[model samples]
Target: MGLGRLSALDPKEPVRRYQRERPGELLHLDIKRLARFEGVGHRITGNRRGASQGLGYDFLHVAIDDATRLVRPQDRRSHAMAGLVQPAPAAC
Candidate 1:
């Protein structure tokens, strides 16, 4: 059978030029702060609960490979009561 038009599937007509790229060629970085639901609460007996109380944030720095599309995330949080104030964009 003959090959059909690639444009029919993807209107963008994207190319696979970067498919064979190597790692570190492209990286993805972001912050994944902990939601309020994932926070810990205190007990009424003047004792701390299982985890920290209130909402907490964790900075999740991620890196990706342009070719393999592999992903790597890094946790940059000291306290569970902290939040990510500023977030940077991923690059390729």
Candidate 2:
């Protein structure tokens, strides 16, 4: 049988989907830190003797969209959570 027109259905009605969408619509974020290791029989120290000894960690933040495949980078040292607040959609 052929499918009938959707005009009979309410315009505001919601539809369910079996498949998932990708890019643009959704965004993912990730964070990473830099580490320093000492040689054998040696231990790492927190004291900074010089610029080389001032080893520190660097945080990496990333964002990926599910609909557009777009990636955006944020700050570091912390996890940034999206979807906490809803924003207006951008122009396509």
Task: Give Cα-based local distance difference scores for all models.
Answer: 0.48, 0.48
**In candidate 2, what are the lDDT values of residues 31-81, reduced to their tens digit?**
656565444322344555543455666666665555555555555534344
Pairs that collide in candidate 1 are none
What residue runs in model 1 are displaced by over 4 Å at the alpha carbon? 1-20, 36-53, 78-92
Candidate 1 similarity to native, TM-score = 0.39
- Residue 49, candidate 2: how far off, in angstroms? 12
Tens digits of per-residue lDDT, candidate 1, 18-71, equal 454554545444556555554334544455646645655545655455565666
User: For every candidate structure, what is the RMSD over all alpha carbons to the true structure, in angstroms?
Assistant: 10.1, 14.0
